[model samples]
Target: MDPRPPDETPGPGQQPKPPFDRERFIFKTLAVVIGTQLLIYSLAAGVCGQRALVGRPVGQICPGTLEQLQGGFDSTLKLLLALLGGAALTRMAPPS
Candidate 1:
């Protein structure tokens, strides 16, 4: 008789590993990345707009703000394209 609890040990023929889920993992990672990008861009837009809203002189604007905003937009676009590509690949994959 084994001293360990039954549930604590794997029985013969009982593989404890769960099945690998590639599709679900990829989609979830993409969702998190896209959400992060969206948040960055939204904050950048707000900061850029604030300077203009308060009647600040044009020269007072931070030069890096525009660049950062543009970079954020570009990154977000790439992430969206990646998601679309993933979806396309999944569709083209052979049915299990």
Candidate 2:
């Protein structure tokens, strides 16, 4: 005979986790991280180069601003695209 009864339900605070919880968690985390990077890139592009801010002189770019813009446009965009591709691949891949 099996131990205990077969029709038992879990008690409160013991609900079963969803089957794709890990995948959902991964997707949410990546979304937040990539979204933040997009925001940063936008800010850098707005503030840097040929723009006159409150204290900054006209046509003077802030140090490291160009690098931030470059990375945001190049590397960050690539990573964001890759995340989309990865998500699609994950959805299509067979369950292990």
Candidate 3:
């Protein structure tokens, strides 16, 4: 009889499975999503330029519309920061 727990015991010719790491999984997923978003945003900004995004001449003073667009971007950045901060905190917490 095997002395190991049933779940820990591997069948003949089978490798033991590693324990699932929730934290690593979450970090990797977030990295991929954030990386993709950055890539997309970089491409858009490069191709479209600030003038296209803001619908104004470059270096010209603008009001309302630029702020609205900038506010949206700022909100998105804040949300991403919050998500990353929460994930970091969760990782630092002691396991239950």
Return the top candidate by lDDT: 1
Query: How close is every model to the real structure, measured as TM-score?
Result: 0.53, 0.49, 0.47
Worst 10 residues of 3 by lDDT: 58-67
For model 2, how does the per-residue alpha-carbon lDDT over 1-96 read when each residue is reduced to its tens digit?
Answer: 788768756789898655677657867886787777778767766776436556566454565676666665677568757877988999899999
Per-residue accuracy of model 3 over 1-96 as CA lDDT, tens digit each: 998767657789999888898767866776776676666556555544766677766453334445555566666667668877998899799999
Provide the lDDT at 60 for model 3.
Answer: 36
Winner on TM-score (1 vs 3): 1
Over the stretch 15-88, how does candidate 1's per-residue lDDT look in tens digits?
A: 88877888779778877876777787677667667866998754635557667767866876787688779889
Q: Against the correct fold, how does model 2 do in TM-score?
A: 0.49
Q: In candidate 1, which residue pairs clash?
A: none
- What CA root-mean-square deviation does each model show from the true structure? 6.1, 5.2, 6.8
Ten contiguous residues minimizing lDDT sum, candidate 1: 57-66
Tell me the deviation in Å of residue 91 in model 2. Answer: 4.5
What is the lDDT of every predicted structure here?
Answer: 0.74, 0.70, 0.67
Model 3 lDDT, residue 12, Cα:
100
- Comparison by lDDT, 2 against 3, better one: 2
Clashes of each: 0, 0, 0
